[model samples]
Target: MHSPTKRHALPKSNVPAVQPTPATTTDLTGFTPADSSLRGLVGGTPVLRVSQPFTSPDRGFWAKLEGFNPGGIKDRPGLHMVERARARGDLLPGAPIVESTSGTLGLGLALAGMVHGHPVTLVTDPGLEPSMTRLLTAYGATVDMVPAPHPTGGWQQARRDRVTELLARQPGAWCPDQYGNPDNVAAYTPLALELAAQLGHIDVLVCSVGTGGHSAGVSRVLRQLYPGMRLVGVDTVGSTIFGQPARTRLMRGLGSSIYPRNVAYEHFSEVHWIAPAESVWACRQLASSHYATGGWSVGAVALVAGWLARTLPRDTRIAAIFPDGPQRYLETVYNDEYCAEHGLLGVRPGPEPELIGRPDEKEVTRWTRCTEIADPLAPTVRTESIEGGRAR
Candidate 1:
């Protein structure tokens, strides 16, 4: 077992920690004749300073609270992709918009559809939260759940296959191929600008890698402003994005079974793979301490960011992105029964991650970090070894 000294460090914040608050609806702004739609509420999210349990009070990171948006971080891409497609005459007015999403993007698409006057269809897997399913449906989106994982590519590919079939049946329908679409990466420019404006100077950026859109997009813009800024990518343990073999993943909104073309492999200085149990611990810690937390991606990202804060210089300014709020995770991450059933309860992660020289050095099964980054799709001497058995 790993040492727990650093992991159990006490909080240094002067303010007392508060319990997480339940969700509520305080806004009921009328959409009068002179008022515009809700598209204006997509950006301008707040940033929270995360300290204490995650990191020492003197060493904390800034978390971009994307949950403040109408949907989540993907709302920027979902709306931008559709808007760009419409401008290029690719998505005609009143046409159907079909795409594959885990959950967050589905909400964004539903919002985009209502804003732009299009019918949206989302293909997802059975692992999606029931609350998320109901919310997407309530937002006027047709949820198509894939029954099983693909033989090789997993649920992501299965959803893509279903989307292909849906597109074949509907004419003039547009599917925002977020995995390969450049618009998804471009959509995060505004977010990067907001971060630069909010923090003045960012020394390091930490992001969760799912479709690889936000990480690549945000880093691209931020690097232009702060050329020396380092980018750290956080992914789930079973994710194939960083060259590990694809396996069944419990966490969503981060990690991928297949390599997404949007991943800016060269931009990442290092990558960390977090386990589901570790994420659960971090999520609960954030809730009880900071009273502000998110789901899988958020938890995983926070874990990595907290480590960076403890190890890096005190002057280092690290910014981590929290994709969505914890409301959708009530049935899973926050549910005691569900966590116990999954063997995630009472499991605390070590302070430091196991370090590796390369991503394909060995099949990582727990919290691991790699400094040498390479594209799994690119040709290399180790590619043969990875294909032979290392990745399996």
Candidate 2:
């Protein structure tokens, strides 16, 4: 499927006002949304459309310079969620902003907290990137490390429980509750707008589904412009979002055991399951080829995006979202030895993987193994999820 160009230019009546002009408008040409970097942070990112030998040039696959942000693509929603919450009176004065972030959201909350003068508390399990924990801590947010349980209820649920308890203890504590917060969905609206502006038009958006915040919000807005738009929900095989049996996951920030109400599954045209090993390897490949520092989820999305870029028709324009930058994943996915030892180094090296793609290869995968794509209409919550590797 191909992206259709805007038949008419957006008139002055319907355009966002540019960010306040600085005293000296030196080299800044484009705009960076408060949430993401369409235009990168000072000297950090540049918007460029790459032409790769592996994909069709006319189709023009574009990736925003998210790594250019202080964090990455998820920064868009991360900041948006907090700013919106404050504007809506969801946050109270002197109340700590609380959330269970595997990574990027915490950074977003940190940035937003700094801008607005509030304290942020992050509750995460051991599987998260140490760098992310440090990044948030460096931003002055309190980090509470919750130990993951064996077999299930690993740090994910623990963090959730921790947030609940913390809120109870501190009156007026504002738990952003990213997983279910509608603001999470709303945060991506501007991102969708940016995508439309940068890419001209986007036919299919292949993105990693974590809290489903990025996908739900971006896809909804894009749909209005491109009704034929296809939103491919890419979840790690261990995540429970799409009625899958829960399993242990290594990739953080991109998958969840719970189907958050914020994740609007109905907007999707289809779902493509991703494996953690594939994600890690693809991430490394991205660095080598594109010179871009891909995040954990970016590597996963890139793996699938590469597939769509190469195999899809010449007319198809595919836009993919890579939420966080690679800096956070230095110890895990981006490490070569880590990839090799985890059996995620390459495409199995040999046999043709069955249609299921060898879910047994990794002890830690993104989603549960039992999910099938047949029921696209299942209830978002009742469909299935596992707090402890249980997808029910």
Candidate 2 lDDT over residue span 134-226, tens digit each: 777888999988765534655677788888888898888898778787878886777778778878888788778888787888888998999
Give each model's clash number: 0, 13
- State which candidate has the highest TM-score: 1
At residue 260, what lDDT does model 1 achieve? 96
lDDT of 1 by residue, 1-392 (tens): 87666656786998988989999976668645433558888889999999989887788999999999888899999999999999999999999999999999998899999999999999999999999999999999999999999999999999999999999999999999999999999999999999999999998899999999999999999999998888889999889998999999999999999999999987888889999999999999999998889899899999999999998888989999999989999999999999999999999999899988778789987899887778899874221121121221
* TM-score of each candidate structure, all chains considered together: 0.88, 0.77
> Each candidate: what lDDT?
0.91, 0.67
lDDT of 2 at 100: 84
Output the number of the lDDT-best candidate. 1
